[model samples]
Target: MNYLCEMSEDKSANEVRKIIHVDMDAFYASVEQMDNPDLIGKPIAVGGSKLRGVVAAASYEARKFGVKSAMPSSMAARLCPELIFVRPRFDRYQEISHQIRAIFYEYTDLVEPLSLDEAFLDVTTNKKGIQSATLLAKEIRERIYQEVGLRASAGISINKFTAKVASDVNKPNGQLTVIPEEVETFLEKLPIDRFFGIGKVTATKMKELGVRTGKDLKQKSIDFLNQHFGKQGLHFYNIVRGIQYSKVKPNRIRKSFAVEHTYFSEIYSKRKILENLEQIALDLERRMKKKSVSGKCVSIKIKYADFTQQTRAKTVLEYMSTKEEFFPLIELLVEHLEINKPVRLLGISFSKLNTEETELDQDKQLTLQF
Candidate 1:
């Protein structure tokens, strides 16, 4: 099923965009390996080894043993017995990220950084006047290696969605290009689970409906999709046909800062819940302080053993950053929560951030469709 002819007829798709998504090769784990020569070529996990700790990132060697980010540290250790765990150095990572972004600005100002490790660059109009985005991506990756001492991978395509997905096709210091003509076949053959935004739950639901691939998804009627997925139905319809319009916004403001933990064992006691909340509050405070931001709203997220989740929030008169300022409010919110069910996860988030007032411009805040 080709979409090129139909896309060319649409005014919104008239402009042929050139976007490149560059993602670092296992960023956190790679940084650890680079800094410490002794850790080279070894399976390493960057995170805590304590009980209830999650793997923040895993080196490629560790990944061979099925260790992955967000996996329980104990599970990761069980997977790879020799996996060396290293603490994350955010300050060091941020320092390196700044240097990498500087390299991106040399080519184009339309750089949308998704994280410290990956970003989308709209090189349709660039400072270097580079016409071939594939060539430009190669150059950028090469520059990142030469200047920053880190290997990077890139994907070049007509839009950000396809570009981002294509980047993962050839990873760990490699590049891929999904040209304008190839986007249709590329998406059609792709598994529904590999469609970037689709998670495990959604993919399982798609499979249950006999939609295992993009080809299968394209066969379903818009009405049928809407009935099942609601508003996101149109999103699936458009993206599969290569019709994403989300631009690479230069200034992407973070809306909130949160800290969450899924416990190794469920906590049924109120005292245990409060103890966990206090620990989460300390982490949240440290993060907020590092960002030098405060918020008026404090929220607590609770997930039960049954996988049901609930959030309780309280808004205060003034912005607060310290745990002391917000912990009491968190305690108050927790007091109202039902404790009949065992809780598997607990989280704390600060919203209505002070940074929003200073950094946000309503007109520039474009919602990413994907």
Candidate 2:
């Protein structure tokens, strides 16, 4: 896809920020392939087996067969009959993630981790004194591969939104850069669905409204967009114009800790569901203890086979961290759920944490600082 756009003569006099978004290529699947030499170049899925499991990640080879993460394993197996399924090793993934973050610290401390596999970095004033953001991205990617044996793709631009969208343009060990002057045209031609916050549902809605690309979106007035998308309409309005000002915050606080799992098959038996919930509780307890924090509220999420989901939460008088202390509460919560239908997923989470409580506003919008 062509990413170039005609440059505007009058560039903004404001200080142009340098942002880079780095995303690991098929992270979990890649790790599986890297550790297992025999799995190289083979179509493998890092998840559960075909009968009753869900896919966590799929290697590029498997992707050719239309397999994807979060897809049901049975469908993935049908798509690629030769697909190999392997369980995810999150501990190992976390270990490697730390190594990659350390490399980012070598250049800039303004690293904002979105997940274990992706992050946003602000390197406008990097410690390395590198004038070119593209070169810095290349160096970071090279270091990750050489040191950690994983391939990564990067996108370099003047802001986080453009940089993030550019990262996916070239994938599986490639990089893309969207210079400031080209940002307008680059966004105009971009597919509506390709924008960072627009998902399938919203993209379908936009297409129904004759907004197929960024150019079409830009044609709508802020009032029109707001009328349709509510508050997010303002977000859509600004992003299409390359007007994003969200900073790459390095020290983002963690609000909650949770653990969840999708079963290989629909579980009909309450006893079986309880068994799974017990294991989930144990896992969550371990994570809480590791962080040395306890929470007053316990929450459980249940997803039925029909794709419907519900969450139930209860707050206790005192902080609790042990499985023994919370498992009974979980049982009580499960009793209230509509389990007449078979359950496909179960999760447990702890909130109202004993750690410093920061009431983060979910809808807070950020503007340009300087």
Candidate 3:
């Protein structure tokens, strides 16, 4: 069924900004695959194998043989003897990226492109004039698939830092979101390396300092972190606590959200699963409030014992009005369940929020996506 949300005019509501990071899957390689049907399943490399030349893109198949973009062509050749190298088609790839951007503009005027293959968009006030960010995302992805014939992954969050990282998690045509309400727990289970700004050097130092996940960093005093990393200490302190007040700059959209949970003995009970729903609901609610916004739609995600996952969401009558009110509706949704199998994880999301700062147009366009 098509996803839908109903939202009243939130004229009194404060606006919450968003940053969405989008990346083309295998970029040039994917383009090649789309152009030539034969290359779809083959180990295709779009670049030179000559001395000093670099690979631009490698199909997923080619990646299995250790081929990677921006890597020396010689290394790629040495790793995969059967690799089929193709020259870069600048015009074609550029055309594809351009088409993708046009779709983005449909959502928001605040678009900041990172590179030919990636971009960040601030959809607080979308051009399509839709209020639900998730629904807009679904529409965007569908458009890219139909119009560009390429798969793109997206990461969405209240800020740029986490959103950029979220896009890379379930890559190659996947879209993920990290709701502000769930930021803390989301970061708690997150690996340190995945945290924004925790690069190789920082990651090493973080390990030494006992700062592993965002939650671990939360344990340290802000002053303590400042002593070790100087200005970055304050930065770490904020992000670890999921306090990314950062805006979705039009020029630098990176990626989307990351969400996972810890399990005790890999649970598999419906009642227990419903109980966990409250935790995820709380998490999502907190993240949303921190960003000073609410979503118009709620989704319940389930991960079964076999690792199979299914998600169901209903567009709501309003943005998350209050946590006290939101949880019960989620409870009602849980009752609609009919999973005959054991459950592992249960997640709930409030999306398609009316959080943008724009005058409500009389010509509202209703769409089903969030």
Please list the C-alpha lDDT of all candidates, in the order they appear: 0.88, 0.88, 0.72
The root-mean-square deviation over C-alpha atoms between each candidate and the true structure, in angstroms, is: 5.2, 5.8, 24.7
Clashes of each: 0, 2, 26
lDDT of 2 by residue, 214-289 (tens): 9999999878987999978778887788876677889766677889888767898878989999999888888888
Q: Model 2: residues >4 Å from true position, as ranges?
A: 1-13, 316-318, 356-370
Query: Top lDDT: which candidate number?
Result: 2
lDDT value for model 2: 0.88
User: Compared with the true structure, what per-residue lDDT tens digits does model 3 show for residues 325-352?
Assistant: 7777777777887777766456766556
Off by over 4 Å in 1: 1-11, 50-52, 259-294, 302-310, 316-327, 337-347, 353-370
TM-scores of the candidates are 0.82, 0.89, 0.60
